[model samples]
Target: MSPSTYRQYEGVKARRRWITVGLVLLAAAFAIRSAQFGNPLIHVDENFYLLVGDRMLHGALPYVDIWDRKPIGLFVLFAGIRLLGGDGIVQYQVVATLFAAATAFVVARIAAPMAGRIAATVAGIVYLLLLGLVGGSGGQAPVFYNLFVAGAALATLTALTRPERNAWDVRRQGAIAMGLIGLALQVKYTAVFEGLFMGLALMWASWRTSRSPARLAVDMALWIGLALAPTLAAMAWYAAIGHLDAFLYANFLSIGDRSGAEAKELTRRLAKAWKALHIPLFAVMLAALLEPWKRWERGPATFGFALAWLGAAIAGYAVFGTYFDHYALPLFAPLAVTCAPLFTYRPYRFGLVAASLMVLSGAIANAVIVRKSQLKRGHQAEMTAMVNAIRPRLKGCLYVWNGDPLLYHLTGSCLPTRHPFAGHLNLLREHGAVGVDQETEVRRILAGRPSVIVDHEPTPRDFNFAVVAIVKAELKRAYRPVKIVPLKGSRLVVYERVEPK
Candidate 1:
């Protein structure tokens, strides 16, 4: 082709890429805003983040001064957003949208070289839709982690495809891969699965032996070093804060040994996710799988990289006892990548139809599930009102027990007690110091000097202490009962400690 023709072709390709990115950005922004507008009240895990982030934003040092189990990487990301987000939900939405968009772009970049632009576009769309459906409308670290995973996959694929690339260039790709892995680790430790998968692909590529084993060994070493850099930084930060134990024990160990019910619940969720993707992607995958393995051989090493990544991911997830749908997220990218080959086969259209239908059906089912799980707005409003009314009259600093996270976020106070007052009465006996435990626990709290116990719906169990009973009898001896406010068809009680002369 003539010089002018070449320039024209390059310009067109550049414009197409820009357009692709723009569409991804627009779609992600819409999804994030929808999630934000749907529910702003804190949910289970989000509440924990809200509590931790609130403290961190307010000058409380994590690890050094406060107790939380999140890795330093997540804390840094949340802190940066919270600092920039202030009190606005829009800020969170924006961060989430940006991450989702980045994830889509990563998907496209990874797919383009393996499949054509058409396949890449489809993959990007698949990622955006899947994340929105699974991640909900709100932006969270999982969404960010998904983006990083995709980026790592792209880098891994590139490194395998171009073994002849210069040592420095290969090292740079490895560094990018490792950096992405580090970011994923910070987002959630479960992301270790993603790193493991990518690493396996890298190792397999190095072993392909078109080159001398020594050169491959040298290349592998450089790449491994780049990847370890981020994790080491996180560990160093943990050591600096004297939180290495908490990182290792509390976060990692606790997740490992979750209760039976938690494990079962996670398994059930994963089963549902498997069905969601399987029914739709199966047809396409079969065609791709049946195609002459020789056809795949024609591509640069991305095919092998995809195989190793998907395999390692499946194996890693299986090895871990704690299972969640989010844990299965890393697998989605490689599966989707592998699915890209189906679009090229003549019969693959059948799979696309099936996959599209499954996606739609799964999305509808997921929406219903999300809706059922949401707390009624009236319930939230009622709880907030009662807590606000009783907070002022209560003595000492008010702590919320078994209360929603908003209470902490809105009130900016510590937990009512580690042992939630909820329905569990035994918590009262277990942790509530009568003359002795109370004297110690209460004195320690008072040392920092806050009074007042605000609790919601005490649980029923051994030593199950009713909030009403605690206020009326055991605690009333020292705390004055102010009022009981009914919330969302439930009850919230407020009390103040009587000052002793």
Candidate 2:
């Protein structure tokens, strides 16, 4: 070929690659745009995370000043975003969008060698679309951590496939992969399952390449240590501050103390998630089972690796025993890669059909959520009104008993107690789970005489009635309802402390 013609062809290929990346990012932004900047009530968990992060910036330590079980790394992410600019709601949304896009890009990269580029790109887009259906439309933990896990997978895949590389080179790649897994662990401990799988896979690859058993054992130990480094660093910091026990309990031990949901409730959640997510689930199963074995470019080994990754993700989701829809976010990337070949299988195009169904269903589900937020005035106007009302009256602090925890950050008011997340103190399932007495925490918060208190009426059925009764009694005694904000099928009543005669 002529030199100019070769350069021109390369240029076109580069342009097409950029275009494909742009498309994936655009899909992620579009899918998650509904819950960006002003929609603080999209998910209560993120709201609290943002609040804890904001407070952390002002010298409040998590597990010490603001209590929750989320790893400190997640809060550090939010705090870092808050450090960049205002309020941090928009910043975190933007960061989450980028993370989602990057994760999808990694999915495409992992699948492109096995499936054609077109098929791989479709897999990435399908992943972004499926996220909204699985409650990952906003800044869920998986949204951030999935990117790390995907990177680890990519690194491990590259090392496994390149057996001609020197032993040191392979070890280096293994270390990088394990380090990424360690970072993921800090975002959510569930990444451990995937990390474990990838670590073993790396060891197997080394052994297959004729490494000695003693060397393999040493390599495994090094990789495991690398994977735990981030968590150990975090523990060391807490130990220096004399709060290691608090960190230990919140990060490791607290989950076991919580009560489990009733079997019926757990089944109901699992059924609901299954109903919403069956199309993608079926697509994953069909692709894994029906793909022509001879067509895979990397042969059965690559396909098996992807399938094992998916199994690890499923184990991560199931280990917690709670089947919340968002808990399934870890599965999307591996599912996408595992199902990519279906997009290019001769005349079937089953992947395209599944993608279409997923996009349509996901769009409809997100539309309903956005419309409900709009109708209830919970996204911007309602929250703004509540914040304005409470901000002016805040002489001491703001207590969010049953409403959005974002109120603490928005109102810029001090917290009444360390347990700001309502469920930790109010949910029957968390009666003794939060490493503190629920009733005592409620009393302590009320005794602080917060300037404004936010509570939701028609309490949720699963709330601890004892804690609810304590808050209600105190509200009646020393606080008067001042502002009522309507939400979806409920009201957020803001109360001001009553002055003595």
Candidate 3:
């Protein structure tokens, strides 16, 4: 009640808040460690990212020397890791845990206003636990990008709602939010849709306070441009190097060029993800919409904001249409935020308890599934052994005819072609001289006279017919098959060059 007593109370509260952050971070490390430290290499995409990063650190350029659809910032992140020189995937996992913990801390802060401290703490832990449920546990783009998105969302929420703050303060917070969103976009373009949602929400807040249509339009335009600057900067960098068309084609047109799965297959994937994560997802969603409605008075706009944010996130993922389980990660933060109602509204306390148990248990279950799918399946070890066997014999570039980008990283050889993952050159999906161009590239790679090559035999339906023909013919003329290594589902053949081109 007195000034001295109140100051002491505030200091104690601050210390307690820091302690909670520490504990939640420990939980994050444990969650990611338990999920993937056992096998670690569940998905090849993460390794593909590392391969590009490693190449860039060695003075090779991305989109020119190494190729993928990943945006520039993702490459910079892994490139920094490669430069730092931590041993293998373990370093990546540790970084991912730190990001996860940071995200959890952000979620807690964002929710603290609506739900009490206890509920906010629960939200942080729940978000960390749910990260393990997705198929891409560690090193996934979402694992890193979600932290930025959550931070952006939190900053925007504060900008709009903190009535005590002056307009200049709110504007500063708005800039911070937009800046975070810009960074998130460079990590993954999927952040664009979520950025749109946050922008609309902030504009609504601006209009509410000022009630000026012209100002809202002008201000929103300025902020939107600022947020999109990273993407534009990337385009300019590539353009300056005369590869702007390459950047545009890779980031924009390449995905559209691929043939999508049939509706039936997409439906199956959607159903499986829904069954795995949606029990908790739906419970929280139902509670959020209905619980506030039953309140004698209309619930606060924060509740509505949570619902809309969750909807936008879900829609952001769904618009892509193919549901890899990790794509479900963005849904959890907003879901966690909205589910704070379970703690506040007595009627839905059961939702909190039920969802918490599901998420925590599912984390373990997902880990086991990944281990079985990758480790028990047995090819990863075999592939590693093959690369180890051939690493000594190869002197220059190593080409994996129909395999993953990780070949270069594991074997310690440079990639002969920027299109290291030969699947992209397959005849079925890509059009517009893709087939002709790839055949020419393959022959060009062969002309370099690499000491070693590894590839698999592709059936008619399996690969590009022309590329496969070129490979077979080139081997017969200039190279000899030295060893055939057996894997679980297929075989890998290593070729040694016998004669010059």
Candidate 4:
């Protein structure tokens, strides 16, 4: 107990804190760099939204002109890019990086109040690492949505810890949290689950301390109402135009019904979920679940709330129940928060470190896979060149097969992109799957009488290639394949419909 011994002990503890912080910083640096090092803005979904946004730039409605189930915010945000300048890949990455940094800060803020400063720093770094692993490049909306969700969680945590504050403080914090939730919903409705959960958690924490049901109910109503107001206003506005049908029927109902697609069986869905977590993360989640129970007074509230949030997010995923890996993005916040406690205990710190290393390793592996995949195909660049070459040649209409984003990005136009596999909509129905209306749909597509068809080669064995095949078949029947040329490291097959010229 001598002064010298005490001083030595303090020094060791300080070093441990610095070391952890240093490691966390290293992880953040890796995440930022990883985002900058990826492919161009030609991802499948990115192309779809880029095209939609390009159309909106010209005052074309999404559902009325093209087709998709994405929320309006997604389109509007992209549309803003077209508004300000153009839809270049670099612009998309810039916005993505900014939003991602904000999300990391939110995680740190949420964890700082619950755990110490060091732990909070580590949680933020962990989130950034996980985000780098999952969020691909080029203006992906989900990345921004994830950032908003994290911000909401941080606001809720602040409200919970400060429940004894004056009315103004509670109202301000509660309202901020509620508004974040609403904004999250505006980005993606799946965000609604996490938003509502956080809102309720904040209200319950305030209620537990005050012991007045009336006070609790009123405060809860106020926050929830304010939070949801933006989303309601957006819906009302979109509804005023005939576009409401597209918003509700296509986005909400059609997307919800996509679960029954043959590719979305429950077994496959659960399996993909497991793969996404991997063994190490699964362990972290288990540790997080158990850690709360051990803390007794603090453990019950914090861990129980985490469990509720985790369960709700999982249930939301099950509802969509598609075998897609991105469905798990909404769960990342709870997963990261709940798993953070594992780092506090010394023994668990080793596991936490191990898990982080595994995540880092996985990121490196993914980057390698991305490189290899790109080397295997030259079609994307070739397709881009083909579109550019054909741009001046066609006058009537240009319909892109496979709905490539480069088409719109290069052409500076928002025209319909035909799908070859749309005929499968009928097949999906024969199998009793709920799908988009293809009967009226096919006729609507041909109505454009596209003067040219740009068909990119398909990814080997992807079901989406069915659409590509359908386009090729229809083109072969009506038009002769004029020339199959190679450009920009890939092949482009151009078909010009025969006319009595």
| Leading candidate by TM-score | 2
RMSD of each: 5.7, 2.6, 3.7, 6.0
Q: Please give the ranking of all candidate structures by lDDT, highest first, separated by commas.
A: 2, 3, 4, 1
What lDDT does the true structure give each of the candidates? Answer: 0.58, 0.83, 0.72, 0.60
Which segments of model 3 are wrong by more than 4 Å?
1-8, 11-15, 38-40, 213-218, 289-299, 343-352, 376-383, 431-436, 446-450, 455-501
Those runs of model 2 whose alpha carbons end farther than 4 Å from true positions after fitting are: 1-19, 26-28, 31-35, 348-351, 373-377, 499-501
On a 0 to 1 TM-score scale, where does candidate 4 land against the true structure? 0.79
How does candidate 2 score on lDDT?
0.83
Better of 1 and 4 by TM-score: 4
Model 2, span 289-360: residue lDDT tens: 777433866746666788899999989888899898889889889988887777766656655776566667
Clashes of 4: 2
Q: List candidate 1 segments past 4 Å from native.
A: 1-8, 11-15, 132-136, 163-166, 207-214, 238-248, 251-277, 280-304, 342-352, 375-395, 414-501
Compared with the true structure, model 3 gives a TM-score of 0.86
Task: Point out the higher-scoring one by TM-score: 2 or 3.
Answer: 2
Model 4 alpha-carbon miss at residue 357, Å: 1.9
| TM-scores for every candidate against the unseen true structure | 0.76, 0.93, 0.86, 0.79
lDDT of 3 by residue, 299-373 (tens): 355666667888899899899987877788888788777666565556556646665665567566666766565
**What TM-score quantifies how close candidate 2 is to the native fold?**
0.93
